[model samples]
Target: MNRGLRIAVVLAGGLAALMLAGCGKHETAQATAVPAPAMKPAPPTPIEVKKEEVGGPTWDPEWDKIVELALPPAMLSGQVPHDVKRFCPAFYGMAEDDKRAFWAYFFQALAGAEAGLEPTVQAKHAQPEMAVKDEVTGRPGRTSGLLQLTYEDQKRYGCDFDWERDKQLKVGDPDRTILQPKNNLECGVKILDKQIIEKHKALLSASGYWSTLRPGTVSYRVFAKQMTNVPAACAVHNARKTVDGTR
Candidate 1:
């Protein structure tokens, strides 16, 4: 080939190599421009309990701490009962720690009304409907514990109460799973979750598991009084549907 033709061929090959390098650089720049995916927020810390609302011959102040630790992660999540936010709008804006504190207060109030915060108190009902026999003990069905749960709750709500082992122990024994404050309160959370979240029942429905949560019942009055002192962060100013009974 002629010299001019040789020079033209070399220049063309060099230009092609530069064009390929430019395309490679463009691809690398595009890859580096992508943004990272967003991260989910961290879960809330455990609640710190300070006091109780109920005092009785059987009430134990230590049960308050058990209620605090017994609360599950879901309870502190956004899935909290709408009635709570409806009655206390401030609950929507409160920090995770404050929300946890409010729920701890709520259970304390409930235990106060249901069993006077008595972890081992057993109550028997004479009303024909509620006077059923205890399936585990073959005796009359009686509500027991800080939340007044029965051995049947183990089947109904998958509670941790073990009557077979507990029967060997004397009554009011702290070793009884039903009488343990943490077990009783955790089971209470599960029951309330099913009622309000799964069953879509009102928090204060007459058909609720606990009569203390049912509005207009004499026991509900006791629960209402305890709610009067919910965490200040709740900002429950108006008489909406609350322990104060706007609900």
Candidate 2:
């Protein structure tokens, strides 16, 4: 009960209170020091097409009718812009034949670049990612036929390639649906339709099925070289207007 003893006890209590306050302040500082979430990168912007023309050498005589038949109405109307970065101008006031011919040239050019127009050609990829196991065939992935399509495309895009029937046949047999020119090109048409019409992607998107359509790749130059003969009606050099302006 002495005054000195009481003073010592009070000092100890105040020291404990000070220590608790310091700890609380330290915790508050730590809470405030947490970093903010990082921002994601922007998507690639689409490029607008300024002109369309073809100058490639003539394709096989037979492919013209096949491509014309496979083309959907939207492509002829210029509603499906294959050049996604460059906006496609609607083919207003143009003849159906010119539009059809232009698309035929485009496909012929694509076929030439993809497989040298060889229906039975099968290409094995060198890249580690592309060489992964095929989903349908359960073998190393290989791009087959004129459009260089994979067996997995049958499941992914409802393509006509039948792996079960194909496995029984020889590698280059024309009897295989995937190796057939008509089936392969038709499958390509469906894939392009999904990209342009269903997904609203550019004809030449980074994530497109065909590497030949992707810009800045070595294969893209091959495809570009084949575009020398696009129909004249698509190239309105003096129009001086955007796709929106065309509307």
Candidate achieving the largest TM-score:
1
lDDT of 1 at 231: 64
- Candidate 2 lDDT, tens digit per residue, 136-182? 89888688988889889899888888888889999888899998888
Candidate 2: C-alpha RMSD to true structure equals: 26.8
Scanning candidate 2 in windows of ten residues, the lowest lDDT window is: 39-48
Among these predictions, the greatest lDDT belongs to: 1
lDDT of each: 0.68, 0.66
- The digit string of per-residue lDDT tens for model 1 on 1-247 reads 4323443564465557556655746676756753321111111111112222222233233343344455566666666667776434687677766675676677777877787656778888887867888777677858888789888889888999898899899988888999888789889988987887778777788899988888888988888777766666677665354667766
Q: State how far residue 107 of model 1 sits from its true place (Å).
A: 0.7
Model 1 — which ten-residue stretch has the worst lDDT? 39-48
At residue 85, candidate 2 shows an lDDT of 18
Off by over 4 Å in 1: 1-65, 238-247
Candidate 2: regions farther than 4 A off: 1-59, 82-93, 236-247
TM-score of model 2 vs. true structure: 0.67
